[model samples]
Target: MQKFQELSQTELESLYHDLLGKYKNFQEKKLKLDMSRGKPAADQFEISMGILDEVNSKSSCLASDGMDCRNYGDFDGIPECKAIFCDMLEVDPEEIFIFGNSSLSIMYDAIGKMMLHGVRPGAKPWSRCEKRKFLCPVPGYDRHFSITECFGFEMIPIEMTPDGPDMDTVERLVASDPDIKGIWCVPKYSNPQGITYSDETVRRFAQMKTAADDFIIMWDNAYAIHDLYPDQKVPLLNILEECKKAGDPTRVMIFASTSKISFAGAGIGVFACAEEMMARMKKLLAFQTIGFDKLNMLRHARFFKNYEGLLKHMEKHAELLRPKFKTVLDAFHSQLDGKGIADWIEPLGGYFISLNVMDQCAKRVVQLCKEAGVILTAAGASFPLGKDPRDRNIRIAPTYPTIEELQQAVSLLCIVIQLAAAEKLLQISPEK
Candidate 1:
């Protein structure tokens, strides 16, 4: 039960050997387990199978505004679809633009549009900025970092506290640097770590002054309704409303999708901002396509009739996800709790569990797990350009595997972690 740091060189060596033996045993089992990405298991998909029947050929294809969904021309999306997001995200119908299955695609297009045409018609395009920069919170979403990297933006790493990104740093950097044009935020049940932004953090983001007039807050509220505990839901302050109150109605572009709720490949994505910004985006979108899939939007609208219905559907997801999360946490508690080598977060509603192993040992642990036939997200993947400066953080995604497979995988993972940590400590021990 002693902490790894409390053990002497001989004791550490012994512990290391024991863990090595266990790891080799796991290798002999030839397990094929993957925890690399936060994908929903097959059983979770079954919960939303009824959505396929929500919109069949026999069903009326008419939207709430009497526009036939089977045809093109509903550019901003059908009224019923917009209304669902308006209620869910607490924005007006005018502010919401429903899109295809992926919110990530919408985000990429948004950035690309700003790069080519600037935030408005006459403003200087971000691509022309002398030194374009973006604020990326550390241990953040990799895809968010990848987007900024793709645009050739200088990604500044902002340390994330339990409340949110360090606001003092965010405020100071943003207010002083004209080149700092935007920030990526996952305010509720944040990716990897489930830390929700405090009300104060949200307010600071809203009221903070930026040197760039076109400063943007890419508020990707992907997990806004993905609560593992339905009765004890975490509230995220509406960034759009907060910006409006701060007299910056167009400061943020909010995004969400029903990818996880209904069907990952067929669900609807939404983007919301001020009415003026919506007009600009729609103008640009006109060149791209006449419309997204209205039938899919209509299907989602009919499936989850309202925000309340959406919540009920997410509760079902929570039911399936809860055990997966619990299994990983329980294993950590039983096997790695008192070990000084690792620490992790117990998230309420996010798809990932963030684990920090001993400094400089994360890659080794991942390598060991891989050798033992277990796959994990690369050690530094959560950071910009795939580099975790401390080299400690690891993202654990448990939702994709069956409970039995997860049990075997996590057991091997813990042994590998202990082995890696022990190896690191032994290398530094004076008695060695």
Candidate 2:
């Protein structure tokens, strides 16, 4: 196939008409497919069904430290449960706080707490600050941006390279601006793009100078152990330890969860920071609730047992996920490769494949896909304010749909991409 850019006007029109015919045929099928979010498929959930049976009405419901799992104490989390997260996050038990289900909720509360009460006792509340800002890496997670946006912080876009966010810009901005309170980081297997932060990026983050005494790095390790290739797993430096080593024990707040590993709505969430910081957050958390679901935590502890158990379970997830991702990538290679219309990353782990279609065409490609009965994440959802400056990047989530569904959806996606690219080169309206 000729590259869309090199094709003559007549050739481009002919190609566009052929793609349009295929697109109309798809529209006739009345498909109800969705690829909007990184949700675990039904089959992936089946592998973790044993967790429900791990704790039952007949179970003792007692934690390892003799605390009743049915009771309200242990706001930080039960001992055995904390031990599992400690191993997973490479932090001490005292440095971790376990919450229910969503790490996103824990993150929201962390920000809200700072806004209402301030970062520490003597510190002024963030709401009172003349200016509040957060650093957001481009083509990043939407929810992360939403959290800071909800708190009324002005979000600054940071360029993301394969290694990670542009640290030169991150260091320079945070150093000069006392208003830049925090930066959102998906350090390992980051959302959408799946680019892990290099060791130097992590080191710089830990050792960088910040003008704000209460500055923070929101290190969200949502895909810490979500490896598609077991033998070739990617390594991430532990930022919490690095911060402590830098004599800035309070500079980082790390979060992780088993939402994907087990039941998405019923799994455990954890927060890790300095022991003193943990103590301070606990005081604020006490007003939120008596405790999170301890019974659920106990069930997870007994089911996974340790970090190795979690890894083994993720291997099963990879078994189910690897093929779905392949279906998308394979379709892209066969149909879209060398077409000069699109580009994509082959992620080793994480839930999304980032596809960059021709500039000024992603929104049209997505609209065409939706018109053909396939749904996708909004074109600019990966960026802050849901606006992609180039209007080219689209996050493809292949995890929720079945392999058969993915095969159809990706094929349609490629076709729409080609049609959109051809339309752009020919300067024709989509209706034409």
Candidate 3:
């Protein structure tokens, strides 16, 4: 609930006084806590240890195709593993290609390949473009930004509407600007903000008529299977199906992984695109290695057993996760609601929360918390080039810490915000 607009000056003073007291107490406690990074908490990892036993040396390591799992041959991935990843993406088996552990690594490799050889989702090698540009929706995944920047592409900032990137800007820039090469999107439970792209956003993305025929859309579906609330799962229109419906199978390259559901580093990665794109990708990937370890693929497939198994594992994650989520949310609500000093999103399932304080105070607020023994993701990391244009967004990761640690951390955060905001206001006030 929010207050109505007409409060007397005395009333404002009383409110600020209460807020100040709360801030001072948080400062006095001086607790050292961290809830900054999105890596899973130790407990979240423990429950999935059975994945290690899913396969063993004594087990029959043979695949459904009669190929030995221990040996390497299927560069694109074993058929069963591809099918599991495909079901997660809601795509056909032919559209999927499984890779090594990290999807981030796969994504990085794609960019590297593009820069050296310039393949844009299997289109004409973008090596032809003298000046390449990429579209980034603000408050986006910093790693994605870093990937594009590493290739020396210009990162153009686009506003993130609640639905998705402002398509009006996206369509115009991509349509008229040949230099604009691609856009990075986390369509489901997007990294820091956890927003799912609306159907219209998906349709518009599929329908973009780019000036550069080689323009690509990099769609990361990292949280496609990570749901905090099973019944409340966020629905995203399948990009593969959407593109096919629009009759443009070549428009996107989709990426996904089993990092959260199982042992992250040991889990499998996946990428899927149209038949044409896959053919082109095969050409590029063939240069790297002759064959990938199909045993791990076999392991993940045997571990999950099927799509239903993946869903079951994700539910166990939710059980461990829900309490941690509640601690942070409850702390924020109990301590700072309507304080006029900060605002944060209560994401339904993602690993991070986007916090907005007064513009320009984010850096100092984060610094203050660090001094008080709480570590946070570096300020300005939610946008391109480690910069939040408004200087107000702070990403809080609650999943990696215990509830007690997160509780203490959120308490410290509330204090840091208040003191920093008050100092800022006082420095600017003329009547003080």
Find the candidate with the highest lDDT and give its number: 2
lDDT of 2 by residue, 180-215 (tens): 999999999899888899999999999999999989
Model 1 root mean square deviation, Cα atoms: 1.9
Ranked candidates, highest lDDT first: 2, 1, 3
**How do the residues 193-280 of candidate 3 rate in per-residue lDDT, one tens digit apiece?**
8788999999999887899777778999988978899999988997777888888788788998878778777788899999888887
As a whole number from 0 to 100, the lDDT of residue 96 in candidate 3 is 83
Clash pairs of candidate 3?
118-126
Give model 1's TM-score versus the native structure.
Answer: 0.98
Error of 2 at 163 (Å): 0.6
Ten-residue stretch with the least lDDT total in model 3 = 1-10
Off by over 4 Å in 2: none
What does candidate 1's lDDT look like per residue over 1-432, in tens digits? 789999998898888888878987999999888999998888888988887888897999999899999999789899988998899899998899999999999999999999999997798999988899999997899999999999999999998899999999999999999999999999888898988999999999999999999899999999989999988898888888889899998899999998888888678899999999999999999999999999988888898898889889999999999999999999999999887889998998979999999999888889888888899999999999999998999999999999999999999988888888888878844123
Could you tell me which 10 consecutive residues in candidate 2 have the lowest summed lDDT?
1-10
Comparing 2 and 3 on TM-score, the stronger one = 2
